[model samples]
Target: MDYQPDGQTPYQNTHSQNMALASLILGTLALLTCGCIYFAVVCASLGIIFALLSKGGSLTMNTSGKIGLVLSSLGLAFTLLLYIGLFLYVLKTYGGFDGFMQESLNFYGVDSIEELYQMMGVPY
Candidate 1:
């Protein structure tokens, strides 16, 4: 008897709706900041969390939440790949970790990591 002829549910899950919107916004931010690995990871992680929470114990998510989840996942993947590529490039350019360390020390005008740390009063 409470049903309306329009056939749509009278009550809306406002909390879920808000969460889905937040997820979408955060996912967009994650994608936009993909070049900054740390910032992108944080945004992507929060986006994924918001999307999952938007499900609200339901087995299925609304469309916005699903899109947010996908975008955040892609952002995380891209961040990981960027870091891996950077590491590989560093290894190839420097010949190894030792070479990289040596170059770093030279750049700092120090003979060794311990010397650099001592110069900076880091208790080596």
Candidate 2:
């Protein structure tokens, strides 16, 4: 029942596990840097990619790598949800930057801030 070549079983490479661990760390960093929208999104994306790749690397069996993959996936999901929620809240509150700017301009009866300044003839 022993399936070993030359009476020595090959050891599993630890690189995949290390990659998964790194993915988890990056995911955690992304979650913490939620305020920086772009950075958080990018980090979360990379984390998810690394986790998936690690998971796909082997299916024979792995404990540490599996754990790292799971953690990284969860972290990625959490960060993605947080980013989506933040985006929705911003959209609902202000419509968007363009809408908010247009509203401001309409309120002042000006096409833009520049027009307002021109109307006032204030040297800038």
Candidate 3:
């Protein structure tokens, strides 16, 4: 048992504080920027790394570190799924923005975007 000079048990923080803080910061950034695909994944990965390191090679983990780990994992998964879904949607919409615009114009019976612009008398 651990006791302090005042005859009361004092709680000592033995967890890896630096790693926990890093994990939390990265996890938060990842969660906030989930739309950024590669960037979010990278941040979440770094957060997960720091969180695991905070465990200090033991079965026990600090509360903050565990929270950081969970947040990082969730952010990573969410961002990855978001990226993949957006990628597939882009593919379905067309190869690129130009193609998407062209397809939309075609659907409206317009032969080309240039012709539509010409009809509107808008300078290209």
Per-model TM-score versus the true fold: 0.71, 0.55, 0.64
User: How well does model 3 score by local distance difference test?
Assistant: 0.85
lDDT of 1 by residue, 12-103 (tens): 44348778888898899888888898899999999999999999866789999999998898888888888899899989999988989899
**Which residue segments of model 2 deviate by more than 4 Å?**
1-8, 60-83, 86-98, 103-111, 115-124
lDDT of 2 at 95: 95
What is the C-alpha lDDT profile of model 2 across 37-63, one tens digit per residue?
677667767776776666554554245
Name the top TM-score candidate. Answer: 1
Overall local distance difference test of candidate 1: 0.87
Which residue pairs clash in candidate 2? none
Candidate 3 C-alpha error for residue 21, in Å: 1.2
Predictions in order: lDDT: 0.87, 0.67, 0.85
Model 3, span 1-124: residue lDDT tens = 4457787777554568899999999998889998888888999999999998998756798877888898899899999898788878887779876777878898867888788889779999
Listed per model in order, the count of residue pairs whose N, CA or C atoms clash below 3 Å is 0, 0, 0
Clashes of 3: 0
Clashing pairs in 3: none
- Best by the lDDT measure: 1
User: Which sections of candidate 3 miss by over 4 Å?
Assistant: 1-14, 95-124
Worst 10 residues of 3 by lDDT: 7-16
